[model samples]
Target: MTFVEELREHAELAGAPLPQLSDGRDRYGPVAAILFAQRSFASVRRRSNGTTLVTVWDHRGELAAWGQAPAVDDVVNTLRAWQDGVPLPELCSAVARYLQAGDPAAAIETLWSVLTDDGEPHLHAIVAAASADPTLRALRPWVSHGTLHLLHATDAVHGVRRGLAFHPTDEDAFKVHVYDGPIGPVQDVASAAATAAATAATW
Candidate 1:
């Protein structure tokens, strides 16, 4: 069975509706549904050029499954390389330096490689820089500011309490329920960005 067929079978087994497929030559093209849950499945389109694009709520559905997906190790290494012990301004400057060195795409690609890897301290810096930098503004829609803030806040609180385990601290306890879980902010930002970008794209 083709990849498309395999996707269909998986969906069917999961009790999802058979994805509506189309011929690219005449109609539109073979499209797949990504079952996010029992009641919701995202529409993903396969282009004639052999690209599988997953529609993100905001930006045109991203090219999720690239031909040569970078390995997890490569992503980890790239994230490690981007780490510079510095403030957000300095970090943004460093990223700008790389962008000015001739290849903005390479710079952005490196940032992406790091962000998608397991959560790292430097990932926060990268996100902050990318969110503010005009050169990297294209990445704004993808970065979850709310989620990042919550993660950092929670980690800080966890670290403090874990370090001072023998002694109970008011500050640590205060931060316990400071922010919502990872999903709340993530969905909020993604949903808002997706709506805005999709509307603009359609126009």
Candidate 2:
């Protein structure tokens, strides 16, 4: 089968089906954009004598990350996993890590998975609490090495960004530091979500 046809079949199994290629060719080769939930996510290209190139974009649609896989099937499987349950920040960061280091292990151990692996349920709690408000949904949360960061789709120059350093002052309170800058304890994820929503509107 041709490249596009094979991609479509694999994507169908992945449950994320392929869309029509826009018929655009760039310096690399023929390119097709992929959207998830109607938002721009990644691109697939045939390049350098039929090699597959997968490029991932940041929320602002900037050139932020890329991943080179052996074939379209590898890309499709990753996409399927991302679609199944991975958070946006994690998905983006995985591609970002791979492109940055050219290491698949780095991608797996980077922002998202690092935060999720602690077995403490912080990622789940934070996400569940954040989901209480839809506006806060715009804020994408990512974590790395004890630090949590946020991103927004409308972000242009740097992408909607926030950072927090969590240090528990007491059982009921944890000191949280903001990316723009911070002070005081957040106490819980709901407060953090509200703070994120308010900040996303203006900051």
Candidate 3:
């Protein structure tokens, strides 16, 4: 089967339909538009028009709850905070330090740290179709157990993985590695559902 077909099958299993890729206008925003969502829950998307849209999708993939934010910066900040599972006050302090650093890459690095930090209750199943590994299949249940968070459709960028110690051995090929985050945290269903909804809108 083709890559798209395979991705569709996996997405179906996750109950999170793949976003539309044909429309240039709706494809992911600039590199700054980082994505975060819980499988089959809610999502948040930063639109091209500078609006952050939060949406909640029901089991049928239909919109359930929706909200728009004109204050895009604030919305993005909130989303990042949620992903980090940190208190708002703490995140605000960290953002303040990051902003004072006056470096864009630093900001991206900070965000990447939160998303893929140790035991992040999320699993990233990045595997090459031709590879010999079938481990990803066994881990699929993590999504249902709320142990999995973001399901990256593709591997992250080079710089994004630099500080996280997640370099792929085959720089040219996809590989799978299991990352452990802080243990046994409950899934924030309400927040995830909203974020998933926003992500679905972008598709």
Query: Model 2 clash pairs?
Result: none
Clashes of 2: 0
- Candidate 3, superposed: residue stretches over 4 Å from native: 1-36, 39-50, 58-60, 81-203
- By TM-score, highest first, what's the ranking? 2, 3, 1
lDDT of 3 by residue, 102-162 (tens): 2333333323322332212223322121111222211111122222222322323321221
Range of the 10 consecutive residues with the lowest summed lDDT in candidate 2: 110-119
Name every residue pair that clashes in candidate 1: 55-61, 56-61, 57-194, 58-194
TM-score of 3: 0.21
lDDT of each: 0.29, 0.49, 0.32
Error of 1 at 111 (Å): 0.8
lDDT of 1 by residue, 1-203 (tens): 65446555554564542444222211112233232322222234443554443321112222212112133222122122222222223322442222122233443343344344323343343344333434333331222322322122112322322110101122111111222212112223223333223332322
Against the hidden reference, what TM-scores do the models get? Answer: 0.20, 0.37, 0.21
Best-to-worst order by lDDT is 2, 3, 1
Pick by lDDT: 1 or 2, better one: 2
Candidate 1 runs further than 4 Å off = 1-100, 120-137, 140-190, 199-203
Task: Give me the candidate number with maximum lDDT.
Answer: 2
